[model samples]
Target: MAKSAPIDDVPTHGEGIRLGQFLQLAGLVDSGGEAKEVIREGDVLVNGEVDQRRGRQLQVGDIVEFGGRKARVSD
Candidate 1:
């Protein structure tokens, strides 16, 4: 069995942020292209379900998982 990823809190400064943008802000990926690539390849998840939409809206409490790292949206 694989170890679960630690939950990290990500604070949003506005209404919400896009998945790709959030991934960059969380330091998950180095560039937008990278984020897009991973997301398109089904390497990212939103609240436990695979989400390939890079422009998916992320609000407070939304959970994002990528590369074994999990980030929870917060105020």
Candidate 2:
């Protein structure tokens, strides 16, 4: 069985953050290149739905899940 990622509240020190960047800031991925790859491959989810846009703007309270891990945006 796959291990569940610990859910965390990651603070975004701004009004919004890009999906690809958030993946890195939240420690979901290692690099911007990896973030783009996973996002393009339909491996990333926003608020529980697959979001392919790497530049998708994320706001406070938004939820992101990838690679069995979950993170919530915070201001």
Candidate 3:
């Protein structure tokens, strides 16, 4: 089994940040366009479901995986 990376300083309560921004912050995808491409191709997963929206709001406790890297939002 592959282990996912840990997200530091997860937000407790907020409107949540943009999915693309989050991916960039985590150093997952190289650029916004790349993120969009990967998302549009249905290569990204959120909470075990395929999430193709680049602007999707992600909250704490949400799990995101892409490009063999995984991240879990923590509070």
Give the top-scoring candidate (TM-score): 1
Clashes of each: 0, 0, 0
TM-score for each of the candidates? 0.92, 0.90, 0.77
RMSD of each: 1.3, 2.1, 2.8
**Rank order (by TM-score, best first):** 1, 2, 3
Candidate 1 C-alpha lDDT tens digits along 27-51: 8999999999999999999999999
How much does candidate 2 score in TM-score? Answer: 0.90
Model 2 backbone overlap count: 0
lDDT of 1: 0.93
Estimate the TM-score for candidate 3. Answer: 0.77
Q: Could you tell me the lDDT of residue 33 within candidate 3?
A: 91
State which candidate has the highest lDDT: 2
Which runs of model 1 end up more than 4 angstroms from their true locations? none
lDDT of each: 0.93, 0.94, 0.78
Q: How displaced is residue 43 in candidate 1, in Å? A: 0.3
